[model samples]
Target: MTRTRTALLCAAALLATTLQTTTATTAAARHEQRCADTSDTRRGEARRVMDIVREAHRDLGLKAALVRVTTDGREVVTGAVGESMAGVPAGTDMHFRIGSVGIAYMGTVLLQLVDEQRVGLDDPVSRWLPDLPHGDEITLRMLGSSTSGLHDYVTDPDFLAQLDAAPFRQWTPRELVAFPLRHPLWYQPGTNWSYSHANFVLLGLALEKITGTPLERLLDERVMDPLDLRETRNSFTPQIPQPVLHAYDDERGTYEESTFWNPSWTTAPGAVLTGDICDLARSARAIGAGELLSRRSYRVQLDPGTVGLPGPTDTCPADVCLPQTEEFHFGVGVIVVNGWVVQNPSFSGFAAVQAYLPSERLAIAVSTTVDQDGASGNTAQRIAERIADALAPEQPLGG
Candidate 1:
């Protein structure tokens, strides 16, 4: 082989390598473009949603943002932006604490029992949880509807002080409920509407007593599996699954990772959960559609007799016992803002929302972790509100 012939072979090999590199780069760009909108069916609106998410990420000073919007069970746009940790890109599949979404799920389970004739909506809590104070007066409907009139234990000053003192302490349902029970009822049971963690916590206990099953296992077999929410699993402790979306907050005077903070006090033991954005969207649709409930049970879940309640009295402050009107009222475990069924939960440093517009069957779910001085407490819900405005202007979501 002469020098000229050898040089010609080397040049040909170099050209082939360059072409391969170019092709790879082009394919990568196309992949990114494809993810801009989840499906080709609604390219126009999905792109607008992607723009909203990017803008929110920048403006809100978010460390990570995950969103999924769907119409009629189909994806409009699903995306994740920012980092779970420095140098680690966020993804829609990473799990974060779902916060109050579990309350909605528990409500669904109670309705299921009603459908099965195992329990009646009006049955006194005394029937299942006779040990509870005022159990006879507080019925199942009241418990699920947040009209039980028990003050929210979360609002109690002592509970807040203890929580701040030991952020990682594991709390039992009874111990948490004690905070509210120690104080007198804000008003007679079932007289008006007021948010109360004790209602749900006691409801969880009643459910376990009635069903003779652990809430964790029951949720998996009934709600999570049936709805195809594979990633929505109850945590016994602070553990999150692999690919965790690390969270940070400045609540203790400095920004610190709080991903592993014990959330046992957030709700019932088996109901504390973590999930990715996709499951969050699916949950919104399930609750919005009443997919698992019978016609009668579903109707009650939406209204639950809270509407037309007389406005708050002297004992119950107007703010605490807010009026229950058709437009913006408490519907069982969820909130009805306009026509959107919603739950927005902020726990530790994690914030998330699951909002569904029943009229259009549109579901928007967002989960976020904020920077030290970034967005407000419920930044995920704020992002969802903007998406709802852009996609379904006629039926806006607010709380």
Candidate 2:
């Protein structure tokens, strides 16, 4: 199977097998709390946008969903639906696991280091992670842009099996990278592009080694604190902080809570995080605007493809190394599609999307969780795409 398909299948299988069952009444209660006290502040199209979020959650059978949209960094509209847990109502302030959104933060920090001249994008990773396969040849740019050719351990059958066996197991970065490192490089470094969690894990480690600071602290100093994202913080344990937007799934044939499932396997220790929709919307603006980067650094962060990187090699076929198009291209840590810069991350029961339109200074952030029978996928991203269409009719997020 292709890597993306394999990863999705593993996630689906994981949702199916990981937890105990919940009663039908409890599941019903969770879904029934849709839009308990949804609030909106946008003018002209407030009700229209709020209706879209509410309808999408109900139609998609999401257990809980939160959405926030901002214009020029000012909150335009915000809404929440469904219960945080069986009987508790979800709110705009509820925190939920954000999955790979942390990848963007990693990329931003790397570019900040580049701006400071502490690290060079083209410098070999061997300078920090000398033991990695072909470490001497791989560059920081390759890791951040996902052109490093490292296998994604999340796609490894053995790793998936182990994860299924122990959903809450705390995985060290070494243990996670070992799975891909055990395999061969898909292609020579910078010769192709493929999304791999291993690349970010290594980049996180290298960042720590170079700065002598924890990844969480670096993120705070560079991105989170400066952006005033007080709600966003690393999750060192399985627990989602209080006022949690609990997630439920029927992947195992019965509705069950997967709210506190460990996410150590998702990314580096300090990179895995949970936050409310407000911070997500703010993050969309800050990261998208390159607010923390130099002009040259921001240019690289958004368009690393122009750095003369080679196309796909024979080993890295077209399916794995997708071609860049006007509507879609992978930038350093962001995905640019149809003039919108975006990041969407999905895990067991949670999914989130953050999208920014630079031309209009528009930002949309959505977080969602599936009901018992709802499909485990990118529900939030689809919802955000709809919202984007309504807000920016002239330039749809989809091409």
The number of residue pairs in model 2 that clash at the backbone is 3
State model 2's lDDT: 0.83
Residues forming the 10-long window of minimal summed lDDT in candidate 1: 30-39
Q: Which candidate gets the maximum lDDT versus the true structure? A: 1
* Deviation (Å) of 377 in candidate 1: 2.1
Q: How high a TM-score does candidate 2 get?
A: 0.87
- The candidate scoring highest on TM-score is 1
lDDT of 1 by residue, 1-399 (tens): 699998999999999999888886774464344334444658788789889989999999999999988898888888889999999999876889997898888899999999999999889999888788888899999999988888898888899888878889999987998898898998888888889888888888888999999999878888999987877899988999866999998877788899999999988778898987888988999998899899888888889999887667999887788888888888778888898999888989999999999889999999999976887679998899999889888877765
Model 1 local distance difference test score: 0.87
**TM-score against truth, every candidate:** 0.89, 0.87
List where candidate 1 sits over 4 angstroms from the true fold: 1-39
Please, what are the lDDT tens digits per residue for candidate 2 over residues 1-399? 699999999998877665323343453344334212244456666677788888987898888889888888666777788877778878886788887778999999999899889989999999998888799889999999998888889889999888877777899998999899888888878777788999888888989998999999998888889987777899899988756888775544467787887899888879998987888988999888889999898888888973344446677765566666656778888888887889998886889999999999999999998877775578999888888889898878764
- Give the lowest summed-lDDT range of ten residues in model 2: 28-37
Give the runs in model 2 whose Cα sits over 4 Å from its true position.
1-41, 250-254, 306-314, 317-319
